[model samples]
Target: MRPFTYEVPSSIQEATSRGGADAAFIAGGTTIVDLMKLEVMNPSRLVDVNPLPMLGIQMREDGLRIGALEKMSDVAEHPEVVANYPVISEALLQSASAQIRNMASIGGNLLQRTRCGYFRDVFTPCNKREPGTGCSAIDGENRMHAILGTSSSCIATHPSDLAVALVALDASIYIQNGAEERVMNLDDFYLVPGETPDHENQLRPGELITAVRVPRLLWARRSTYLKIRDRESYEFALTSAALALDLNGDTIRDVRIAVGGVGTKPWNLPEVRQALAGKPLKPETFAAAAKLAVNGANPLRHNGFKVDLVQRTIVRALMNLGGLA
Candidate 1:
């Protein structure tokens, strides 16, 4: 790891003043330390944000506002979260392990790096790490590459179950930079890996995530996160679905769907939601909606099976949500 200066600011303004292009906020240091050890990330300074007072989960009239410094385990185990938002709890429980969940912060989870093998190896060309350097996964092993929202410049998948669940819940992020505060929809927070794959988020220099707000939903209580991986536990998803359904006498009143593990971002299926709106929750209806989920999938050579697998996963998720399986 490179030698770097460390700073702990007492206030957000002080932190922003200390942060720069070469500085990064250290929350849990799980993901950051790993990347630093791999030489994928080299920062000249580390700003410890844990000392700040922005570290609480509160239930507001509008929704649940989770502080960026809140630990993953605390958020997952919060009574309001587990009782009202099962998808969020399940997504957190299924990610990493108990130890990691204990140490990883909600903000760090949102900013975690991709699990792409090529991106981890500094010697390999990764467009996400080094712009215009070429993507090694394009011609190399790409079984876990993205099928949706993939550009020629990059095919790396976003590897955050919590982010996928949050997207499905239509969450928003609150950002602060020296008293200038702004809110952004979670869907728009992450950028597509087009020409500038190195730029993953919409956050600017010296900006810090303050909190994430998830609006209250009637269907949120009935939601679930279904993850399918090669192994059962402590593994990334091959294809996963975070779904919430509002049912009115077996008819789908409203549906929220976000897919993970097969897309460059948390793939929200608006078309599928449109197809299922006001439709009866039946097997055939789910099958048809599932078919529409992967409508424009651009699978790579080794990941063509993901197209079919994702469709099946969506169908199964729908079935599970409707209790029709």
Candidate 2:
């Protein structure tokens, strides 16, 4: 890593004050450190937010409020998160290895970059790394790239397991910049890689993510996360699904669905959710909605299997959560 100055901010205000254009906020340093070592990212300053006040898991009248700095392992194993939002807990557990989760922070996880090989290598042309340069994954090895939310500029998929679960649950991000604060839906925070693939999210300059609020949904307790990968552990997903269902008898009352490893961002499938509303929790119902999961998909040569794989994964996740599989 290149030479850089590091400062530990004792408060959120201090953290944001120091984090500006060429400065980055580091919580666990899991993502930022890797990029730095690769020389893909070189910030002049690093503002450490670990000592800040944003570091707790709490329950409030609104919903489950998870502090931004809370470790992934801790949040996954927390009584409230594990018992109430199994999807969230499962996503975190199924993420990186035990050691990485112990060190990675929730906010950092949400802001994590794509895992596209071309994007990480400085030698390759990646629109995400250098805008207008070009995207190597477009015509190269793109089996793990995105099918949905892809533009001619880039097709790298957002690699956040936690983001899929949170987006499915309609979570909101609490952000603070200086003394002002704002809240935005977790789904709205991520941007599709259109012409400007470098502009990834809706985070404002000098803003710090404080916490994520997951509103308590009656059906969330019956939620689950399913990840399909080449191997069992420490592998990024090829196609993953996060599903929550509220069933009335054998019929579905309400459902939420978000997919990962298939989109430029954590993808929400509202059409699929709408299709399953009031429908019987049967194989036919799942198969029909699963088809809609790939409604706008544009698959590459080698990644065409993902079109069908994502659909099957969605059906399997829903069935497993609803106890119909």
Candidate 2 Cα errors over 4 Å, as ranges = none
Clashing pairs in 2: none
| TM-score, every prediction | 0.98, 0.99
Relative to the unseen true structure, what is the C-alpha lDDT of residue 264 in candidate 1, on a scale of 0 to 100? 88
Note the Cα lDDT for every prediction shown.
Answer: 0.91, 0.93
RMSD of 2: 0.8
Model 1 clashing residue pairs (backbone) = none
The digit string of per-residue lDDT tens for model 1 on 127-235 reads 9998888999988999988898899999999999999999999999998988899999999999989888888989998999989999988678999999999899999
